[model samples]
Target: MTGFDSHLFEGRTVVVTGAGRGIGAAVAAAFLHCGASVIAHAGRDLSHAEGDLLSRVPSAARSRLVLLTEDLAAPDGGAQLADQVLARTGVIDVLVNNAGTMGGRIRAGEETAETYDHVLDLNIRSVVALTGCLLPALRASEQASIVNTVSISARAGGSAGSALYAGTKAFVSGWTKTLAKELAPDGIRVNAVSPGTIMTDFHRRYSTPEKLEATAAAIPLKRLGMADDCAPAYVFLAAGSLSGYVTGQVLEVNGGQLMP
Candidate 1:
């Protein structure tokens, strides 16, 4: 449904985590629209997909979408998802490590070991595990691209109670750069998409209406972002023809909220 070429990703295979709803679903749908066979990890359940993700794809493209449900926070969760992917295909043209969460806003002093582990496990550990497991498949492709989901909070030190989540994102940002350099030898490029305050369910749960309004006012664009606004960045980064020379970069889709 985007303005991108329908055949942009023809004959390619893409894997997207957290695709049941919000930004992840939008990203998955975008790739499908562009003609890629998509393996979408729909979080821990398919309930969200029935309404959110499934509604986005037309009936014609439904055949190209494969939905899987997994709890990426569980033990060896990433590897388990990778197993499902490998069973389906040996070559992955694009890997979008977009499954992550804030886990909720735990105040600095109020945090516990359990909370720390939960956030780290979901945001950092799972991504590393998934990407590691998929390396062989990625290397099989003539050109492979890895796109990670980072956040404005990574650099801006997000609002109070989000320190742990922000730290995890920052870690991924650094990892994305490191992997880009390390994987370049194999013709695989690694990059990340840092989204601004998008008006998705993520904000609905963590950000109050008043806070969202204030934040929107502060942005130069005078509004918050959307899942669709962030989807194009993933498509652009995944399409080698579009960003063949780009790597180790964090493309910001924050609507001028952070100029840097």
Candidate 2:
């Protein structure tokens, strides 16, 4: 919990999706701590924020926080969120596409068309739609940075029951690179943060304690990661002062789990 410069993001506007809890909440709070006005999409509800996210922000900074709730898996979810953002601000300094989920385990061969739609809708379609909808605002900034949330599972192929989720992340990893190149001319940098085995509710619902312990034992650092551990990377990637020249890269925050 080291402190960042209070004025690092002064006068900036940042939008973070999936900010109700876990990694998204930490990233949103980090921007608020650094003096940015933030628009946080709190998933489908505010239940997770009551205890987890709201407590993390200082009262003084609360004035700069705007919370929105939308189900990104719905047909027009991304567009709806973007409309809200546009109504609030004309320009965006940072966009963190962190709203995504595995939607539970659908084992191989047992995957239904319904499951496929849900996974893709939440993970891939929503991201594309949101980013596309916000491109003009992003371009309006003198310099804008997009930090997407990918997963180590994208590369490792993941363990049982998560192949579809892994594929979506892989798609995002590739899209991040492609968007970096496509948007470079507009002075917008696109990159991604690929977290490895974070100990969030994501794992609580999708993984067993035995499996998590085994993962920790196998990692070179002998532990899984925490949401705080991944937050600074987003801040670094989002701040032009910090990572102005960095783009199209997947920064790994895995506690040495994957060297690549």
Candidate 3:
């Protein structure tokens, strides 16, 4: 997919949250590759991400990249980022709401108020707050899109320890459809990409090697997915040329792990 023409996204401005690593990083890279000026946001700092990107991205792409490090969990985080982006660029062509988390496996009986709050805050609340902040910019674009990163867990109710996290993603999945209908009249497409058992730092913490092997064996593909594997779905959704008539849909990138 490299060597794309300069006109692909010549003047487009894309905002990708939680782009410091994993799928977020891959999404940012994909957008940059297609000639879009990308505003990549990280949660705390960009020290590690900066190094990672500098090592991979070409010099020309660096000029088009803007790395933002803001704590998305803060009450005013979304507004602050939105204001900054609007100040620099009048419009945001694409908004990828990919910042999320899966709190460790804890049963409903073992959960506490704080646990639920933390999980829900990052998974769903932040997406709503951030999108609200950028609605104006998104509405300003003649071709706008909001691609959310959901999970296959949402449909399955998740594995034993991930029920709460799955519930939050389920809310996002439902909201994506509702918002798509509401925003369709304005030409702003809303959709989601659901990834399954990707091999990333995320899984390193939540799933053991044995567990991953078992998961891979169970999948029809007999392999785990990479961050790159999931990035193209976001690009396809963001690119009006490809997914112009597509909206309110969930594109799953799980190698047939979950049919629904």
Candidate 4:
């Protein structure tokens, strides 16, 4: 159940999406440490060896790492990503849809169809299609889990920076609950992780210096979040023995940033 609890992921096969950097990269490292073979999937940007994520990872577990690239936002990309993993691993025990976008915001009148669609395409549509495509492979495993990376934007309303991004994540907030119910009977667990304002590239891009400091200062914990802090939640959900009864839950990793 915990990455610290046990090597629960021993011999498992996992995929870490948007894994070239930031949170996704951190997640891949955690899983690799737990004895799982990792498929490091990324969009166009984070692709190869040099500054690529897999390279930064030390050689300790490098043999378990398989670095690959695919743009999940484009048509057929999700299926292609799954297909690539299937071709090599032949089966997958977990799928982590961690790839996303967070660079746009517009009020109702100012929003464009293309912009909205782009966000939805990568954040929501890709998740759905990839989940469908990977079902067969996931089912073949003795235990399977799916973790959708969501955001505080999924429900919080105060952010002027996440107008459209939040809307797309709201779909994630609702869909993961429903998907969990639908997939439970298949012996697979589906859940979402809604992280608060972390110091990821996404946050760095959207937050001004003043805004960043203010947001961190306002948190009850007096600090922003980190990728390492959030990655273990995914590990727990993916470990059946540890989180066999956990499903359809959104585990928030923010530091008292959004309270219900």
Candidate 4 on 1-260: residue-level lDDT in tens? 14353265778899888888878888888888788888888556554334646644668778988878887777677788778787887678999989998646555667677777677788878788888888888888878899999888787763874677887788887988998999888898998888898887776677787988999999999998987888888888888987899999998888989885
Q: Model 1, which residues run further than 4 Å from truth?
A: none
Residue range 157-179, candidate 2, lDDT tens digits: 88889999999999999999999
Q: TM per model? A: 0.99, 0.98, 0.95, 0.93
What's the distance in Å from true for residue 67, model 4? 1.3
Cα RMSD to the true fold for all candidates: 0.6, 0.8, 1.6, 2.3
Report the error of model 1 at residue 241, Å.
0.4
Which residue pairs of candidate 2 clash?
A: none
Task: Estimate the TM-score for candidate 2.
Answer: 0.98
**Local distance difference test, each candidate:** 0.95, 0.93, 0.86, 0.81
Q: Compose the digit string of candidate 1's lDDT tens values, residues 1-260.
A: 75978899999999999999999999999999999999999999999998899999999999999999888888689999999999999999999999888999999898898999889999999999999999999999998999999999999989989999999999999999999999999999999999999998899999999999999999999999999999999999999999999999999999899989
Tens-place lDDT per residue, model 3, 22-133, is: 8898888888888899988865688658655445567888899988877666656677767766777779999999987887887879999878887887778778988988
- Model 4 stretches with alpha carbons more than 4 Å out: 1-6, 47-52
Could you tell which candidate, 2 or 3, scores higher by TM-score? Answer: 2
Error in Å for residue 30 of model 3: 0.3
